[model samples]
Target: MFEAIKLLVGVVSLIMVYRTITGNCNKYLAFAICAIWLRYFLSAFHTITYPSLVAGFSINALGSIGVAGLGLLLIPTAVFTLKKLFPFYVFFTAIAVSGFVNMQIPGTINVLVKWCYFLVLAGALFLSIRCQGQNETFKKLLVAFVMPVSLQMLSIVLGEAKATEADGSTSYIGGYNHEAAFSMIIVSFIFVLGLVNRNAISFRTTLFTVAVVLLVLVNYRTAILTILPIAAIFYFTLVEQRLKPSQKAPVLTIVTMVLAILFFVLSLSMQERFADVGLLVGNLDLIFKAPMYFSDAEQDIMSARVYIWSQYINAFTNADLLHQIFGFGPDSWKHKFDLYAHNTYVSYVYEYGYLGFISFIGLMAYILTASFNLSNKPLGKILAFSLIGFMIMNMATMPLWNIEGLIFFALALGTVFANPSAQKVSKEIGAGHKTSMEIN
Candidate 1:
């Protein structure tokens, strides 16, 4: 049964990849599929999931063949030179160089695969940036981005949920693994949608957002921290425009209903958390002594980050110069603590060091500046504000370039930067062309 399920996943992945290799796929659509679904195909074939070595080899070979087919499809527009792809050139080159020098590069094969993954996504970014204003194409990509994710999140919620016998609070982890990425896509969509109408929530957008918000509540990972910024950004960038007289009452009604529903659901599911959150009220001690609360929950929950973060930093400090500067290669966190550094600073500094670290920050600054300054007026400002929210979330989670979801953001930035009005398409990607203070 499991094998059948795995094979089905591989078949679905193969179909999407095949469509992309042919001229039948939207570029953004292809990216959405890759970001949301392709990794599942790989997982279905991994040794731990599938005991058959032949299945493993077969899936890998199939994926490579599909990618090679895409290379052929790109022959006409593949006219990229070193100068055009400078950012990616530096990004991949630095990581490869750093990985080679690291003494702890044990998962060398895995590291190589990761490099290839980054390359393919970077290539997508280049292509998207290189070719812009395909409205029909962009719309299709947006559908691809939003639909699968919505269904996926919904499925996670509908499936089995466990209620703690002690607390009676139900916990539904759902099937969604990439919580941060999911939220980023959600807010980005909200930004784009608001940009489209701007006056008020379109009926379609209202329903879509309410659904996505419910999904976030169930996932409950970045619920509070991530949601607030997204809401605030939507209001500041998309919401607080000089409202037409007609919009006031409807807007208030919608906001009130949405907030009420969200509050009721959240309180019902995680009352324990809500009760503990009260610890923040009246008791200022919990605020200052937040780190002292790890006895309450796991690493991802309340204040546990403080404790885990300390461990990662301590481990990083004691390491030698090689490990300090170059990092321990991709997925090397197991040697230090768990599967990943709970903090971005610890992750980048320990994994790729200053080379990766600086690249991450530089890329963030460049994209954010570009997002606000695109050629398309409403679209640029909308994406810019929405993207600003995404970047802020990224700081607290993954560095910009490392996470899968940011692949879309990078692609969007590339598209924005490539626009004729914002700035000329420089021969260099991250070469020193500064934005005007007005745009920034």
Candidate 2:
């Protein structure tokens, strides 16, 4: 009975989000739905045990279907809405279709699901680029889409920390640890969107600050590192110009550097009493000493990745001609590894072979090229950069296939690529110049 109610709530929530994306109702309704979904999913995951009926059957099947439906609704709304503003929607659709075909093979439903979700997000991103030409109200609406997700992430972090303190065990109900990292990525995009809009400087700054603090608390090293370069690019290209001549960029940089050094030193100094801090520092030390220990280390990170890549590559190459061209059907990798390829590039190669790989790359290239051309709009530029950052991070991480990650990515893309009905509205409001200026 409880399971049925949960499933019903999921369906209703997704409908609300879809309506919000379509501009058919109050946008806040969509935000509420996303927040509820995030919270419920997290709690549900935490309470359910692994390999149990709930995890393997109910959550994996019905829950995945609900998430996939949400993606489908958003992607179409983004593409159809922005078809005129961004012609790349056609190319993205083509790639998605090609991927779907390649993924349709037996035992590959999981892979197909992932491709469907990603394609939806790509389409939504195209729409977001289209909508950037609209007024500030549209931009605010985009931010609203992400705000609830971010708050839900914060809640997960707090709840997870409390659970850990009480039980002395790690719990990622609904994959909260990974979702938290994914939320950081989404918040980073929101920060860029806020920067581009410029109408909400204070709000954006506060959110960015909150995101940074949360990121630190979560201590997801890869996420922190992945965002650093993007933050640097944003600071230099966008934030620095807005600063007064008297403001010292170097001072801020030095202060951050000094604080980092002090924090590390303090953490090491307290190693005797704080086993957690000691473990963290010890891990950092090992990472730094990787080069020196490469020969002796039992597990070599770089070598392990190369080995995995080689295995996937060899598997694809050994396939028969028909399999090579059409690829092993969706979820085929499970027969061999019982899991995904772990690397997106390898995953694509393994699932779709070379033909599908080219088509996927071509679609990504098309969207990126179109986005670059539309860089005149701050929001467009930021979205383009964020996508690039996301792609880089995905090379080493598989969060791209996760539900929370896909939803956030799709929503952000939709915001940037939205097709507004009010092109003339911007011209009448004297916002045309802002949209027409060169990014550089």
Candidate 3:
């Protein structure tokens, strides 16, 4: 039954893609973004709900094929170059070099291929925007994302959750593999929607948001912190703009009190779970120290993230110069350790090496700078906060390490560059070049 629902969603998305190809709808770029999201939804749903390893692998492989095939079909419709996209270009180069150096390693080769596929997918989306206007293309992107995510989130209510916690508490993963990943995707989507519709919250939007927050409360408690910014932004949109100068302070006070009460209630409900969070906070200083110095008790904190992170960093530090520079190929952690790095910074540095890490950081910094500049505009502000939230998530979890994280990165930055200001600059530059050519 569930399989049929998945097929139906895929078919509908393809129909839209078909219409766009036929010129029935010019939302080619939007459909490209949808293609990636649909791939993630289908792959994740199948992998988590069913226990068949072979079937899961097949679904993921097919999803990759679909994404690549669609990218090939749409890329020819638009043109872009890697050099102009400086951040991604440098980062891509670093990964490629690392992959070449570690070509014999199966994991590195796999990582290299996936990165290439994602880069092509992103390029196709960018080209599509160049062909169609950014505004229309972005609106379609929003619908493409929000609609599918809404369906996936519906699993929170309809599907049975699994026991993800040792306490026997159920985790509402919404059919995704892990609650953390599920929450990240949901929060990012809500953040994107809030940013696009920043002026006011509709009744439907409020309900959807409340439902998501409730899910977060049950599944990943840490995401609750991430949602604060979204809530603040929404508050400004819903109340700050509408209030008079004098009325603003009083209303803000009332809202603050209400939120405080609500937060207090939430904290009480999750007191037991939050004990680990408190321990991590209390031992925050340990993060600055060398992992070798950690006592057994310290290593056990934050679900052993501290110990895991220390091990990765220690391995990198102990490696020879060549491995130190390029790191041990992609997914190298899998070869050396039993668990994931849990920290993206640790993961990148260990897997890609210093050069790859620097390139990745440079890429993220470039994106954040672009996002920061967009804060002045209405739509740009959404892009800014979304990027911030994604970075915050990376501190503990590896969002960029998986397809979901990459999807958020592409969607957020793609929308950022697609904003009117960015597009206008490109247009002016093109016009200037054209005029110079005419004079020549």
For all predicted structures, in order, the TM-scores are 0.64, 0.60, 0.79
User: Model 1: runs farther than 4 Å from truth?
Assistant: 1-85, 103-119, 122-134, 143-159, 162-203, 235-303, 399-403, 421-440
**Candidate 2 lDDT by residue in tens digits, 1-440:** 43344345446655655656566433333332443244344434444522336534544445555555675765444344543333434434433444466555334455456545545544534443443333343443443334334344535654543233222333222233344434444444444444454454456556655555555444443454455544545544555556576775775566557656755674475343334323434554433232323343323343244335556666777778866765665556777774466566677667666666666666566556555555245545655676676666566455555554555455545444443223433664575454432111
Q: Let me know the TM-score candidate 1 reaches against the reference structure.
A: 0.64
Higher-scoring candidate on TM-score, 1 or 2:
1
CA lDDT of 168 in candidate 1? 45
TM-score of 3: 0.79
Clash number by candidate, in order = 1, 21, 1
What is the C-alpha lDDT profile of model 1 across 1-440, one tens digit per residue?
Answer: 43454365456546645665356564644664455345344433345432434634445434543553463454334433524445655655556767678644545444445444544554554455444333423433444343434444444455544343234444332233344444445544543344344333347356446645654544434334445544544544334355676886778567657766766786677566555434534553432243435454533333344455555566666778877777666556766575454456657666777677787677666666666666556556656655665554553455343334444454455455445454443423357655322211
1-440 per-residue lDDT for model 3 (tens digits): 64556556656666755554555335446556566566555655665533534633456655665576666666643334534376776776777677678763556655655665566556655555556645445444554444345446555557746676435677765455676666666665665466444333346357546645655644666566556656655655566667899998989888878777877887788787667777877867666567778888887676677778778888888889998898787776776799888888888888778998998888888777776665246455556666676676676777676665666666666565544455445665778843121100
Q: Considering only N, C-alpha and C atoms within 3 Å, which residue pairs clash in candidate 1?
A: 83-427
Cα RMSDs, all models: 7.4, 8.5, 5.0
Worst 10 residues of 3 by lDDT: 431-440
Instruction: Please report, in order, the local distance difference test score of every candidate based on alpha carbons.
Output: 0.50, 0.49, 0.63
Give residue 263's error in model 2 in angstroms.
15
Best by lDDT: 3
Q: Which scores higher on lDDT, 2 or 3? A: 3
